[model samples]
Target: MIGEGVAVRIIPCLDVRGGRVVKGVKFRDHVDMGDILERAAAYRDQGADELVFYDITASPEGRSVDVAWVERVAEAIDIPFTVAGGIRDVARARAVLHAGADKISVNSPALARPDLVAELADAFGSQCVVIGIDSIRENGRYRLRANTGDPDNMTDPDLDTRAWVERVQALGAGEIVLNCMDADGVRSGYDIDQLADVRGICDVPLIASGGAGTPEHFLDVFRRADVDGALAATVFHSGQIEIPDLKRWLGEQGVRTRTGSVAS
Candidate 1:
């Protein structure tokens, strides 16, 4: 199911802070947009397969995940949602799950212990855990970035991506979210080639984040990256592209997406 014409996913990401739905410009520009409920409801109605809620500044200094906000958003969205921000351990992960999130994305915490992935898998199902990776092309080479990668730890060189994949998989992570920090918002498109390279080495589902400017950008990712899902933040938040329109566009471009509405 991983290819250009497969049932490619069009996922909208909501960057949150202080319990408010905010949109950032390239992982650095922070601006509040509206209440979480409205934006999430909009994405769900727009026909997104799923939505991502990221607490943009959850981990500058080992901060804890925002539980109340997660709970609120989980209660608000109809489609499955992932809450990630300062998820560093099993306890925090459990809290996120209990708050109603279908999935929890892990970053710095996984890098630190590596075993947290397995621990979370044992506690929650493997499907509940997604490993978020931030990659950058330096001197024509893509390397991992340690800060919440892709507007995600949000850190430094942590060995190679291949090694990280092996360890995280052994630890029982169910999916890998390859986010190119370098491509965060140039809007050119996703680093499908980069994600494809990561996919070639990993068996888990790969969610390609960063660098989505247009519907064509999404098509390029699905066609070239062989990813399970494509996540975008700004276009969705800034009102450049609507979710239903994007999904319909994907369908027109020969990408598979569920045909239904929030009210349906």
Candidate 2:
């Protein structure tokens, strides 16, 4: 169960690729799910606490995020939604915010230029910035990828995940989204140990991403890691688990959550 005071957030991620929402395993083998605007509104109607719109292929394809598409989704959904991908500088971040996105999520660009985190926090307030760290455990240690960018451009420093979290927080990131590459789309459970380690290092809110298949998996993460929020894509898109049902079950388990209006 989550601790006293703060309510746990249930966020649904819409991994957009080429203007369409897609879901994949370990960020590969993606299948088109639906139109971005339609899915965003559906999640909001389903009582999602917040929606995350990730342009999954933006960086790899060397294209800026489709600001026009973002405008369309923002106009369609009443709830807060985050827009990410190819947000390389404050100008791009500003453009997304102007397009009506409530927040901007950054990955590899932040790793390559740590100053961007501080710059964004300084310009738009820390709350508007989310630092996403994607990791995979190997050789008894965790290595990170900023995001799936071109192989030639990606620099795998394989930095320690915990240390990296601390750095980002110090750089003024208001939230951390820890993505476990190994657990991503596997649907087994969240990376509890990994979340705990990152949580211990930073005082900022942590969102555990990847591997959320069952409602029980959420309960486990809340009880064990005490993450501020949980993010999933395939399960929600597949209709295997609905946000309202999950929140209701969580409430029954003594976890405080915002159930929104309750989906009819």
lDDT of each: 0.80, 0.86
The number of the candidate with the highest TM-score is 2
lDDT of 1 by residue, 75-194 (tens): 777778888778887888888899999999887667777778888999998999998887777767676666663443336764777678777887888988888876887888898778
For model 1, state the Cα shift of residue 226 in Å.
1.0
Task: Score every model by TM-score.
Answer: 0.91, 0.93
Candidate 2 C-alpha lDDT tens digits along 85-183: 989899999999999999999998898889999999999999999998988897888888765634445557668887788898999999999999788
Q: Candidate 1: misplaced stretches above 4 Å? A: 1-6, 149-154
Candidate 1 similarity to native, TM-score? 0.91
Q: Can you list the residue pairs that collide in candidate 1?
A: 4-223, 46-244, 146-155, 146-156, 147-154, 147-155, 148-152, 148-153, 148-154
